[model samples]
Every structure is written in structure tokens, then in C-alpha cells.
Target: MSQTLTSDQKDALQEVTNIAMGQAASTLATILSTFVTISVPRINIPEVSEIGSAISKMVGNGKEVTAVRQSFAGHLRGEAIIIYGQEGCRDLADLMGYDEDIDQSAERELLLDIANVLIGACLNGIADILQTGLTFAPPSIMAERVIINSLIDPTQLTWNNALLVEVNFTLEARNFSCHLVTLMPEDSIERLKQAIDTFMENF
Candidate 1:
């Protein structure tokens, strides 16, 4: 099935995402003790088969990366995947004062910490703005030291289409960067549209 949104709906979602991402970035900056720059949130509704490719294009291909996964449910339900490049991981470790004796497990912990902050803050912002509630499962490591293209297998997904919201967070001075991609299934997409409509009506 094809999932589509009207021009007005798209604009509303983008605006909501921008505000939410800014909150996430701010939270991250406070933790990292540096400025966090965020890209304008890019939203897309793509078929299951194209999900992997679309994400690969966003984060680039053939670069070793690590990712963390978290699922949220309630008025809004979906999964959030945060992809961090190898260099980005190292930078994060150093910034977080993990430079000494930083082993594999320590690195994974760092990635999860970053994911939790970004995903929780961003999704919560959206939920609050939409006047809804969301509960998140604990963040976990999805992939480690793998290429971006291999991060996810779209063929294994149960949904034929999904609404994807992509946002990038970068600490240019520290050479740290990551992508936060949120995938809401078809049913949730319909619910989100209704929520956005309600928000617009109150404006």
C-alpha cells in the first residue's frame, strides 16, 4: 500500500519535526558540553523495499558505523534508529571522557547513551506538541562496525510502507555526527495525520 500526505500535512509534520529535533539537539548539547547542529528534518514515506536504500543515501554507503534501536508505543508507535559513523563514535567517547580504557563494551554504552538522549527528547517533544503520550523501550545496540547499507534488512519488515523522519545531529568541532531515523508504520501514519490535523485546527 502507498502512504501519502497532503501538502499541508507534510508542512505541518515538518514543522513539528523541526521543533522536536531542536529540543533533542539542545539536550544533547548540554550533555556533551558543546554546540549541536541539526539539519532540517527530512520526511519521507517509502515502500519497505526502498527503506534501506533511502537510509543509505542519507548517511552515505560503505562507511563502517554503529547504530542503536529503540521502540516507542502509545498514541504514537514506531522504532527509532540512530546511526553513528566509526569516527563519530571515537569522537563521542573522547568527549564523554571515555578516552582511557575504552573497550568495545564501553563504546556500545556510549552509543546507547547518545541514542537514548536524542530519541527520547525528540519523540517526547513531538508527543507533547501533538497532545499525546509515548512509552519507549530501552535503547539497545542494533549494529556495530557495519556498513550503513547493511544496517537494516527491509525485506524482513512486516509493513509495506512507512513514514520516515530523518534528522542529523553533528558536533562539527568534535567531528561527531549521527542520524536519527524514526519509522512509523502505516496505521500510525494515519493516526499521526489525524493528530496533525487536530493541531492545525487549533492554530
Candidate 2:
């Protein structure tokens, strides 16, 4: 029987995210010089439909619904989505020195910049730690009403055809929230364990 990745997988995953997240934090810190620190939240595989409400609750009581979807694909192909209600995004944009009268084009431009900083840092973190390099396929903006099943293709990535291990971050100072979906391929599940086992053996 194949060994399942236990809660210990979460701990290991946290360490992996920690390293990448720290790098991401540093990059953001340099850009804004705001001392960014990403929190290590528990990973979740909630239903796709639940994401809107889940994220809304996280940002809480914002009049305008603002969500920016940025997707990155490579060896590990998936999305790194940033979401907030409209009010929250406007407030964040204003705080970040962006003006009002925001439209799709303007918003798209800003979102892409954020995704680049984040996804670049995120990929760098993974590559350095895994001792392998990962290439990006460019980020595309995701629609606000994306259904969960849209991205899950059994043929492309098989960790599971069902759900993704999602990590959410809330920027404490600016109250801007972002989510990272680290997709697991079904076939690669075993490979991850083997890698971890190798890592365990070293420790």
C-alpha cells in the first residue's frame, strides 16, 4: 500500500512555505519597506465553491468586492490568487499610492505587478530549497466567478483531481489578503513522500 502523507506532511509543508514565504516577505519588504511577515497558517483543501465566502469572511465587511486572480504554471502548475472585497482593495490600493477610478485595465496592471513579485519570490523559494529550478508560464487574471472544477485536470496534474492544498495570508498592516494554492499531482504524491523521506533520513 502507498504510504499517505500524514499531518506531518502539513508540518513539512509549513517549513517549505516558511522558507519561500520568508523570501516573499523580504521582497515585499524591500519594495514597500514595511517589514512584511507572512503568517504560517494551516493548509486547507476546502471545496472550490466555498472559496468566495471563505475569503469574504477573512476580509470582512467590505462594500466593494475586489478579487485579483493570478495563475502560475510550471513543473507544479496552479494558481496564486489574491482576493478582497472592493472596499478592501481600494483601501489597499490607496494605501499603496494608487488612486481611485480603478477599472479592469488599471486593476489588471497593478495585480500583475503584485503577482510577479510574489510568484517570482515563491518560485525562487521552491527552486532553492528543492535543489531544482522552476520556470513560470506567465500569470493570467482569473475571473471572479471561476468554478472549482475549471482548473483541475487529471491529465495535467494528478496529485488529486479533486482539491488543492491552499494557504491563505492576511497582510496585518494593510489588511490585504492573498491565497496561495500549492497544487499536488496525484502521481507525484509518492514522489513528495520519497523526497521527504530522503529529507527525513538526512535529519
Candidate 3:
């Protein structure tokens, strides 16, 4: 699981992720009736332990955050997480047209829907490009208003290396941001490489 991807492999993966996330962002924009922008996909291959630091930095500076996690299995199996910084819940509600105060139940519903849309759309887009099928479990709130340091446990996972693809999303007209992270195990990375190679050959 300590295997590293060559520069070529990393570049190919980044290309795939960029297209996938673009499709996802477009779908979100349509749903929200506003523009949605996503940062270029960033692919990092880091040691298992160092992953937490990367995730922590992405989660944000010392602010409280919200995390939603969903698991998928098929050609690729792993967790897809969306992290939000402080005031994220309120801002998202406002953007979604919640003109008044949002109750706790309403906030939870909004977060789940957002997580599902982002995670499902992004993963489905990736799966479609890879010509593969994937099934995802319902997304759950892993933490809300919690510090990033306590959000995830890298040691509890068995994978020795991970392909972490990060895509930052910003909603147009709102001061809100979220981080989308796709964590694929070593074997999943192998499957992805095979799929990418096949796709390139046919292109």
C-alpha cells in the first residue's frame, strides 16, 4: 500500500477528477439557481499518518467545522467527506433560500441534502468517466461545530497510502466554502489506474 503513482499517473487522475468535479459543480449550480465554482482538483499521495495534517489544513484554521461522510463501494470503495467552516450551516441555509431562522432539524436536512448532492454527483461523475458502477450509503453527519483535530481517525483505517483528491466549492453570492475529499484505498487506486489506462487507450 506504500506504492506511489508516477507523475503521469497522477496527472491522468487529476484530469479525470477535474472533469468529474466540473460536472458536479454544474449540477449544483443548476439546483441552487446560482453560479457554483470549484477549484482545480488537487491529487496528493501522502503517508497514512500525514493524511490527518492535510485534512486538518483543508478543514480550516482554528475554526469549528462540520463534516459529512458517505461511503461508496463498487469499482472504488472509500469515504467521501465534505467539510464546512464556521457559519457554514447558516450561510448554506441562506443561499438555499431559507429567508428566516432555520431550526435544527431543517439545518440537518439541508446539510444531508448538500452532502448527498456533492458526494453523489462527484462520485457518479467519476464513475461514469471510468465506465464503472458505484453504490453509496446514505451520508451521515460525522461532526458539527467541532474542531478538525477530532473529526477523523487516520490510524483506525487499514490503508497504508491514499489518493486524496480535494475540490473546494464556493457558492456564488455567498461567503461560504466547503472542501470535498475523496479517499480511495491503495487497491482502489489500482482499479482506477486500470480504468484510466483503458480509457486512454480508447480515446
Model 3 ranges off by over 4 Å: 1-3, 158-161
Ranking, lDDT, top scorer first? 1, 3, 2
Give the winner by TM-score: 2 or 3.
3
C-alpha displacement of 137 in model 2, angstroms?
Answer: 1.0
- List runs of model 2 lying over 4 Å from the truth: 1-4, 45-88, 144-172
Q: Model 1, which residues run further than 4 Å from truth?
A: none
User: What root-mean-square deviation over C-alphas does model 2 reach?
Assistant: 5.1
- Candidate 1: the clashing residue pairs are none
TM-score against truth, every candidate:
0.88, 0.68, 0.86
Q: Write the per-residue lDDT of candidate 3 for residues 46-142, one digit (tens) a residue.
A: 7777777777776665768888888899988988888878687778888877877677778888788778887887778678867888999999988
* Candidate 1 structure lDDT: 0.80
lDDT of each: 0.80, 0.52, 0.77
Which predicted model would earn the best TM-score? Answer: 1
Q: How do the residues 126-177 of candidate 2 rate in per-residue lDDT, one tens digit apiece? A: 5454555666666666544333333233344433321222334445466555
**C-alpha displacement of 123 in model 2, angstroms?**
3.9
Q: Which is the winner by TM-score between candidate 1 and candidate 2?
A: 1
